[model samples]
Target: MKYQARLSLDVLFKFIFKITGLLVLLLLGGILTMLVYNSFSFFLDVKPLDFITGLAWNPTGSSPTFGMLPLILSTTLVTIGAMLLAIPIGIGTATFISEYASPGVKNILKPAIEILAAIPSVVIGFLGIVVLSPGLANLSNLPNGLNALNGAILLAVMALPTIITVAEDAIHAVPKSYKEASYAVGGTKWQTVYKVSIPAAAPGIIAAVMLGVGRAIGETMTVLMATGNASMMPTGFFDSVKTMTATIAIEMGEVPYQTTHYYALYAIATVLFFMTLLANLLGEFFINRFRKYHAA
Candidate 1:
């Protein structure tokens, strides 16, 4: 009787887990469907090509325009800048933590890095306003400190913890036997790390970087606060620009509900959702490819 009861409970748990997974998928599908429906509604009134290629984004004036090119360019520039700034610093810190740090140093530093990830994005945005923006203004002689450069710097700082943590784990996961063999062949510590461990962990490192890119690009408040929120073509690193996220965040509340402007925000959200999804899919592809290669 007890054995039968235990078997019944096991089946019940399995059924619950299955339902949980299905529910998550259903929720995601529901969200995607809603976004598509609303965005399609907006497209009925506005041509898709015009929306895609438009350089202006005045949605409230007498002659309101909805060109998203500037917003897209701004978002792209900041993401690229953040990734460029963060990748080296993140990977280097990860490598040091995994390979070079003494046990005592590692113990102290790992938690410190993790704590950085816990810091609020709003706080980071405020810091950008207080500390980073003023410095950039001084360095560049720009009238205002807030610009793409400021936003990129803030996003890079926010992304660093995730990249460092994930890359460190990947580096640490490199098979001890690989390192042993490299050293057995008389390779120096640096050579073994650079040539063997890092090579072996390349897929994971790439995935980590992609994930960091997703985080940097999707960030809203920090970019909104620091990037001057200009709806213009970005001319340089110092140029003020507005990202899709910031546009949505800033306008979603003030716009009349169910208006064309409201639907446009959903369209922007749809783009963001797909961008993050693509990044995650790319990361998964690398991870799976690495697994297959390792198994082979």
Candidate 2:
């Protein structure tokens, strides 16, 4: 009787899990459908090539161009810059916490680092505006610090906690037997970490970095508040630029219903969604390669 009851419960739970998964897929499909439906009007008026390749984004002028190259470039620049800045620091911190720290120190440090993720994005943006911006402006001799660099710095800060926490968990999950084998071979702790532990954890670390990239790319408030919101082609990190997310947030409310400009915003979102999806796919590809190589 007890065995039959257990089997029934298992079937029920499986059904619930399948329904939950289906719901998530439906939600994602609904969003994509909405974006495509709304943006259809914009594409009818503008050539897809012209919209993607054009440099201008003037939607209010008499001519009213809808080029998206500038926004795409800005988002790419900020995300790349943030990843470059965050990757080393986050991985190194994770290594330290996982491999070197005493239990007491790890306990305190892990919680402190996790607390950083709890801080509101708006507050981080405010700090960028008041603190980091001025300092960067002074250092670079720029008129103001609100630029791609400032946004990258803030995004890096926001991405750090995620990268560090996930990477630390991956590093920690390395089997004790692996380290023991390294010790038996007279390998130093540092040697084992770089040679064995890091290699073993590569898949997880890659996933963590990709998550950080997603966080950096999808962030709206921080970039909007600190990126100077210039819709020009950026020549360097010092130049002020506007990202796709910022563009959508700023214009979506003010745009007229069903107008070309409004539809263009949806188009931008569609592009952004594909970009994020591509990043995740690439991350998965790399992770699979690493896993296969290690297994071999």
Candidate 3:
């Protein structure tokens, strides 16, 4: 009787899990459908090539252009800069916490890093505006520090907690046997970490970095507040630039529904969605490769 009851419960839980998974897929499909449906009209009016390759985004001009190249470039610059700053520092910190820290130090450092993630984006933006911006402006001899560099710095800070936490978990999850084997072979701690532990954790680290990229790319409030909102083609990190999320936030409310401008915003959103999706897919590819290598 007990065995029958257990089997029934298992079936019920399996049915519930399947239903939940289907619901998630449905939700994602619904979002993609909505974006495509709204943006379809805009693409009809503007050649897809022109919209993507054009440099101007003057929606209120006499002729009104809807080029997205600047926005795409700006987002790419900020995301890349942020990753360059965060990845090395985040991974190093994770390595220390996982491999070198004493129990007490680990307890203190982990919670402090995690707490950083809980801080609101608006608060971080405020700090960028008041603190980091002025410092950079002075350092770079710019009038103000609100530029791609400032946004990248802010995004790096925002992404750090995620990268560190996930990477630390990944590093910690390396089997004790692996480390012991390295030590038994007369490898130093650093050598084992560099050779065995990091290699073993490569898949997780890649996923963590990709997750950080997603966070940096999709962030709205901090970039909006700090990135000066300039729509011009950025020449360097010192140049003020606007991101797609910032553009959408700035214009979506005022844009008339069903207009070309409205549709263009949806198109930008679709492009942004695909960029993030591509990042995740690449992460998955690397993860599979690492898993296969390790398995062999």
Candidate 4:
């Protein structure tokens, strides 16, 4: 009787999990469908080629321009800048916490890093406005600090917690025997960490980077507030520019429903979604390749 009851509970749990997974997939499918439907409506009015290749984005002026090239360029620049700033710092912080920190220091530092993730994006944006922006402006003698660089720096801070946490977990997941064997072969701590542990954990680290990229790319409020909201082509790091997410967020409320501008926002969202999707796919590809190589 006891064994039968246990088996029944196991089946019940499996059914619940299966249902939950299906619900998640359904939710994702619904969002994608909605985005596609609305974006298709926009593309019917605006040529897809014009939307992609246009150089201006003034949708409300007497001569409204709908070029998205500037927005795409800004978003790409910000993501690249954030990754350049965040990746090394995140990976290094993870390495230190995982391999070097004493238990007491580890407990304190890990919590501190994770706490950054809990801070609201608005608060971070405010700090960028009040603190980082002016300071950077003063240092560089730029007209204002609110530019791609400002947004990128804040995004890097936002992305760091995710990167650090996942990377540390990956480092921790490295088998104890591997480390022991490296030591047995008279390998130094640094040598073993670089050659054995890091290589073994490459897949997880790559996943962490991809996750950070998603975080940076999808961020709306921080970029909206920090990036000065200029819709133009950037000439340098200090030049102000608007991102697709920022544009959608800043203009969505004011644009009349069912208007071409309204539909364009949805199209921007579709593009943003696919950009993140492509990043995830590339990450998966790299992860699989690394796994197969390591296995062999």
lDDT (0 to 1) per candidate: 0.92, 0.96, 0.96, 0.95
lDDT of 2 by residue, 75-147 (tens): 9999999999999999999999999999999999999998999999999999999999999899889899999
Candidate 1 per-residue lDDT over residues 251-272, each given as its tens digit: 9989999988899888888878
Give the runs in model 3 whose Cα sits over 4 Å from its true position.
none
Kindly report the root-mean-square deviation of model 4 from the true structure over all alpha carbons.
0.9
Worst 10 residues of 2 by lDDT: 33-42
* TM-scores, all models, native as reference: 0.95, 0.99, 0.99, 0.98
Point out the worst 10-residue segment of candidate 1 by lDDT. 286-295
Spell out the clash pairs found in candidate 2. none
Candidate 4 worst ten-residue window by lDDT: 233-242
Error of 4 at 131 (Å): 0.8
Clashing pairs in 4: none
lDDT of 4: 0.95
Task: Give the higher-TM-score candidate: 1 or 4.
Answer: 4
Flag regions of model 1 displaced more than 4 Å.
1-9, 291-296
Per-residue lDDT of candidate 3, residues 163-263 (tens digit): 99999999999999999999999999999999999999999999999999999999999999998999999999999999999999999999988889999
Report how far residue 211 has shifted in candidate 1, in Å.
1.8
